[model samples]
Target: MTIPLKLHVGGMDCAACATKIENAMKRLPGVTDISVSYGQELLSVTLDEDRTSRAVIEGKIRALGYTPAGSDVARTPANDAQAATAPWWRSPRGRLVIGTAALLAVAYIVSHIEPSWATWAYVAATAIGLVPIGRRAIVAALSGTPFSIEMLMSVAALGAVAIGQAPEAALVIFLFSVGELLEGLASGRARAGIRALMDLVPRTARRLRGSEVETVPVEALQIGDVVLVRPGDRVPSDGDVIDGTSGVDEAPVTGESVAVLKEPGSTVYAGSIGIDGELQVKISRTTADNTIARIIHAVEEAQATKAPVARFIETFSQWYTPAAMAISLLVIVGPPLLFGADWFTWIYRGLAVLLIACPCALVISTPAAVASGLANGARRGLLMKGGAALETLSKVKTVAFDKTGTLTRGKPQITDIVCLAGDENDMLAMAAAVERGSSHPLGLAIVAEAERRGLDIPRAFGGSSVTPGKAVTARLKAGFVSVGSPRHAAGKSALTPDQADRVAALEQAGKTVVVVLQGAQALGMIALRDEPRPDARAGLEKLRSLGVRSVMLTGDNARTATSIGSLLGLDVRAELLPDAKLAAIAAYRAKGPIAMIGDGINDAPALAAASVGIAMGGGTDVALETADVALMKERIEGVAALISLSRATMSNIWQNIALALGLKAIFLVTTLVGSTPLWMAILADTGATVLVTANALRLLRYGNRRSD
Candidate 1:
């Protein structure tokens, strides 16, 4: 019976790391299935119940220079606590172990000694130095599968002993161990990126109870609980500020380097640091529901979903391993037994062939490429949820964009406020007072404008109501004050012939006019417009260059959408409602894979429906949650760059896979056809592994040309 277990692993930095962990685990005795993801810092292992223990699996990871946390086996409290901390590489012990292993390997490799002596020395040193750290590998190999990299290595070493060639056997084990150690270190580096993200969420929060501060675990924080946040402290949960004020540095959360000034009633997210001042925030979400938690969960889920290419390798390996073993047996015993010739020499040669046919290189090729691609993306602020998403992104043919925040900046400002009847001050004052009680973006703009002009806004009058796409109505001392869309007010006979012309002119300029009326008489109008992002045009062109069709979808009128679309050189402009946008995405997906880029609550449904959804970092929670990929920087150019990077990554992965498999196939054939020497087989296998690894690492240097 295969028992599945989830282990929180540390020191993985990329998809390659996940692959390395999986490969290492599969080499264990009872491991039936294994999956590791650097994006989530997790390892999923399926093992035979009677053969392997959780301790054995964990020990393997440690030997590979990774820290395994959260398993069914015994765990130290300190280790569990540290699991909630920063990147694994930041830990003193993990660093020390990696540093020591690396130094020893380098020193041993550089030493000028006889091949036989050097081999034994390296093997002995690595076993002594890394075995204690990587006990999981030994235990896993011993308990479950009778054949593994360790088994092959041990056999090869003992074969030399059996033939009085102890030095040769030792050297073989040593070089192989060094290769394993190097692979583990690379994996650790890749996993560290995900761990860094997880570390952002504070483990505890300071709750306020009637002026007394009480420290409580973040998980215990409930909605509506007041939490006191001091300067330089990380916000423990997402909430609204009910008291105090501060400038929050949201760099870690939004990837924005600047500190945003926040006041009373402003929303603050978990993982953001309080740059200055104190704040008493009323928690609006639980720890599990917080933004950081959701991000972590999404990343983890994505990592678990395997890529199509990876799945192929796993399926192929099932038959490949058994077939290779059988072939080795035939070459070793079949011919000599049937022909009545000496078996010892041929058997020894067959064992050498078996050692070289481990398929370690082929198994590792695709994953290393995936890890490298993911890591490169992270450095450029593109957060792909997993290997599956990363693979899908490279194949996107058409991309749909949500207008607000996706193309145009989500923030709409009051560009011009005109008062027709009453004085400018009085007109502005009345409009701001009525809008103050509303939460709409337009309302916020009005309030912000009033505050900018140093105008004091009175509380909302009694019986205030807001109508979407229309306006706000308030019962005031003068009479009924209606503030809304120009068309709505015009329909109510509030606009004069001249005022109507002015409205038309403003509409032509892509500005939204809010008409303010008192008792059916026009008072004034406020003009607002969503600012186009600076990089929108350039990004659209770049996407076009990449052979991706760019389409703009907006709820605004056709003229407005067209005007913006034309400016950005978009191929299609669809003035659509929220449902229409979702339908549009569906329509496009019917043709082929489509990527939807959006950053608003309205875009959430469409994002979820698209083949791949990309969210702007500063977008709404709904958009972020729905998006498959999140770009931390809110620049349109980043989107194009991400596409380019994804394609580059996919190409690299395929190349590595081809190279590894091609080499393995050729070597296997040569061994079967002739008397393949032990040294030659070892050299070819190790050399091919190194070549694939180096090729994958080239992805790290991607985009360097542009920088240069």
Candidate 2:
């Protein structure tokens, strides 16, 4: 069997580190695939276990001069605190800080006491400060990527020292180290946000064991265990309330600010905080399969998939570094050989060109913003799959929504009652009694309405049968009662003009008109309707504000669909079956990228067919699996928020790209003129990287405009 291995690789300071690891691992005979994520500090490899062992993989990683931590090595409080207080020399950042400080101290002392030895003092500082950077450069070169940023920095710093610019060279390495430290910290922070999601789950859970409460590790929690939750504590796992009642705050999982009331049978998720009451929850999911776990897993998986722009940038970077190297070689050899320029001066200029062409900032421009965007969306109850969906969402010109459960609450309610002959109350009571044993949605609506009106609903004399989306029938006291579609109610007899007119009026107003019949005689009619969500209009208006057109696709009849569409000012494609909905999505594609938002069950096909599939959180697991994005809040406004975040993220990515490329262009030109100093070139390169990273992190603050 091909087993997957996940390793937490240390000392990966940049994207080039990931590339180098991938290149080295691909040479192994049994390794079929290798993916290293600098943002996550994770290396995922697929290999035949029989052919290659974990020991072999770890050895290879060690040989490449990187520490390999196993997946089981979790970041606990003790370990985290220890890491925080570790010695400065132990970490790459600390080493750089110490090395730079020592070099500066040596330079100060030598310049004051033995001024003639100042050059040697700076040279010694360069050698010490450049160790970490030089090691990575050599590893990358040996791994077949000769034009990594480390390589460029190493060459530029060494060339400076060779030209008798030891002080400049030391300063360049110092600044470069500082930049690498900043990038590492930024990348760590981004991954930490994702890791913090796991932290939200309590490590210990109070399990109910034979009337006594025992504290146990969350990992030991099993399905069907009844866990006791007290006030102010996070629910330990995904479960249902078996006893007691309380208000559970599910913001960590659903992003809903308000705490939902949980009573017996109400579902609760892991990471929800209990407030004001105690409840015993029967675990439905194990600790590793909780909602929070799925979300964290989804977000990490999403980040692994590259966005279109990120892929383009990755491809561009491959050629970009080699092109920069070629340009640098030309600057060194071309100027002197072709124009009789001074060799030493031209060489210095060429090294400056190399420093300016590191491409660290450019290579990271898209993924950084993309990673932040995914995290931002995840925190806000929006689950966008990856950069591809995030980027696609921004370009979607049209959004198609499933009407039921998406635009409306999906719960049908009794709206009207018309009596042609029998008493209105009597007829409704009969209808409710006939549907009492039926599990159909409309039947449930009728039964609920009867109970609300205090009607006496008698038991059916025999078993009731239901035809989906049509009718329900049962044996009653008088004879037989069949509550169903208007056609079914008519049953070989035409409806009176008055009855027909009443049904037409009700249907025209978007109500589902059902006929109550006894044998061949039509008794009366009852109308039910699923009301539009309170925020539906406002959410659609937000879409319009963003210049995205909205359309409603529903399986409802034309009259009902039109009424709802007109009410919300949306373009309507009514009476669409699941296949028809998919077909509509196909037709919309001709106009532009179309986003299909649905309840994620009945709409799964359509969701998959659209450019971007958005699922409501309450949707089935299959629907969630098929969707590219999910709004856990089940709000139409989530569409607007998703688009807003995508646009902001794409905008942020472009800004970083422009900033990196713009600064590099200016410095490259200045370096060729011999006016740009080595420190300035190094500073520009490092500064651009820090600037772009800071800009990308701003996306973590994205907010929702409306509630679901």
Candidate 3:
């Protein structure tokens, strides 16, 4: 059987490392697929477990000078003792940083104090610093990627040493080590946010054992285990609040700042803090099955799916490195052969050009930012499918909304009742009797109102018949009664002009009016209205402020749709059938990219028809599957959060791209004109990579200001 495995592989420095590992693993028998991310230090592989073992895979990575960390790797007492007694120079990265700093200082002192021995001292310094950097370069060369940044830097530094510029060579290697240190540190910090999220889940949980409280590992906690969460304690797992009430601070998991009140039935997720009360929660999920764990899994998967721009860059980079190598070769041979320039001068200049054009910074720019963006969104309760959805959301100029479950709560209530014959209770009693058997939401609302008013709602004696999406009819004590939409009821029941005017007035006020009939005579009108979500107007206002135009698409009457739209300051397209909503999306797409927000099986087609479909309510399987992005939160504000998150992510990606290309361009031009030295060129390339990565990590701060 084929199973997936993920390992944290250390020592991946550039995109070339990922490529090298991927290429090596693809040749292994029974390996189905592989994905490696330098930013996350993650290696995910699908392999036939019966045919190959993870030990063999780790062995292959170990041969390439990378350490693999996973569950199967056991720690021994001897290894622990060695780790504790390890010296400052035990860590290759840390040793390189310290050695480079010491060597650079020595080189500077010797160059000024003793000119005669300065060259030898500088040579020693370069050698000391080049040990770690040059080894990786050689490994990369043996792995078939000889044009990586490490390789380019190695070539440039050695060429300087051969040309009697030992001080410059030492400085170049020193700066290159510094850049690697920075990149490693930045990547570590980026992964730390995700690690911190994992840390929020306590290692052990307090579980009930008859009369004893047993301290057990969270992994040992199973579904239906009752766990106690004390005041100011993090919930051990995702479960229901069964014994106590408190305010829960879900900010760490869901980005909500205020503490939400939890009762007997409230859901408490793992990593949420129970602020002021002790609670007993019945575990609903296992340790690995909690919401936070699922979020982490989703984020890791999201990072693997490349953005459109990242794919283009990846394709461009396939030839970008070799093209850079070719250009450097031409720069070396072309100048000396064609222009009669001095060999050593042109060769040194060519080496500088090679280092300047390495493309490491440009290639690393997008995914780091993309990973950070995905992490940011996940922390905020917004599950962006991947960078592709985020990229699409950034360009969305028009946002279309479904009225029923999106803008308003899907639950409707009977708010107004008019009787043409008997008292209001008699009309409601008759209507509720027929509607009680109907499964429609409006029907349920009428029945609930009758129950709320203490009316004697009777059961239907005879068999009831209902037209789908129209009306319900059943035999009552008085006569055969029909309760349904105005048009549907008008066909089966008699309507007076005065009663018809009342229905029209109610419909115009955004109330969904259904006629109640006894035999052929219309008894009264029942008007129901689904109230707009409390945050609907505010969320729409936020979207408008962000320059996203809002449009309301519904199958309701014009006056009702207009009333809702005007209240929310949105463009209204009333009386739209499912096909009309799809056409509306296409029409909007003609002008610009449009996103549809919906949460119904009927809305699935329109959701799929738009540029990006954001599924709200998360109730139906069809809406979840059809939409591009599914919102776990049911509020309209989640739409605004998504838009804001997308804009920030895309903006960060562009900034990184521009920074990378801009630095490379300037340094490339400088190297060509003999203004930029080998050390400075490598520094520029390394600095740009570090800058873009650090800038991308800024997205970890996104959505921190979200309020309750």
TM-score to true structure, per model: 0.72, 0.90, 0.82
- Candidate 3: where is the Cα deviation over 4 Å? 1-5, 27-32, 46-56, 63-65, 71-91, 105-115, 276-278, 414-503, 513-526, 555-562, 574-587, 600-602, 618-626, 703-708
- Against the hidden true structure, what lDDT does model 2 obtain? 0.83
Model 2 agreement with the true structure over 1-708: per-residue lDDT tens digits = 788788888767556667778987877778876889876668988889788888888877775657786664644434444543455467757677777877867886897799899999988988888787788777667767778787888888889899899888988888887787787777666665676677779989999999899999998999999999999999998999999889988888777788899999999888899998999999999987778878777887898888999888888999998998899999999978999989999989998888888888988888889998999888878888888999999899999998888998889888888876678888999999998867778889989998998999977986787766667778889778888898765553737877888888888898988998877778889999998988899999999999999999888889888988999999999988777877889999988999998877778788889999999864235434668999877778889989988999999999999999999999988887778999899867789988898888888866645332
Ranking by lDDT: 2, 3, 1
- Compared with the true structure, model 1 gives a TM-score of 0.72
Scored against the true structure, residue 235 in model 3 reaches a CA lDDT of 90
lDDT of 3 by residue, 239-347 (tens): 9988888999887776666788998998888899988998889999887778777666666667778899989888898788889888998988998899899988888
TM-score of 2: 0.90
Please say which candidate is ahead in TM-score: 1 or 2: 2
Backbone clashes for every candidate come to 24, 0, 0
- Number of the top candidate by lDDT? 2
For candidate 3, the clash count comes to 0
lDDT of 1 by residue, 625-688 (tens): 6578887667788778888888887898778778877876776667666656555566555666
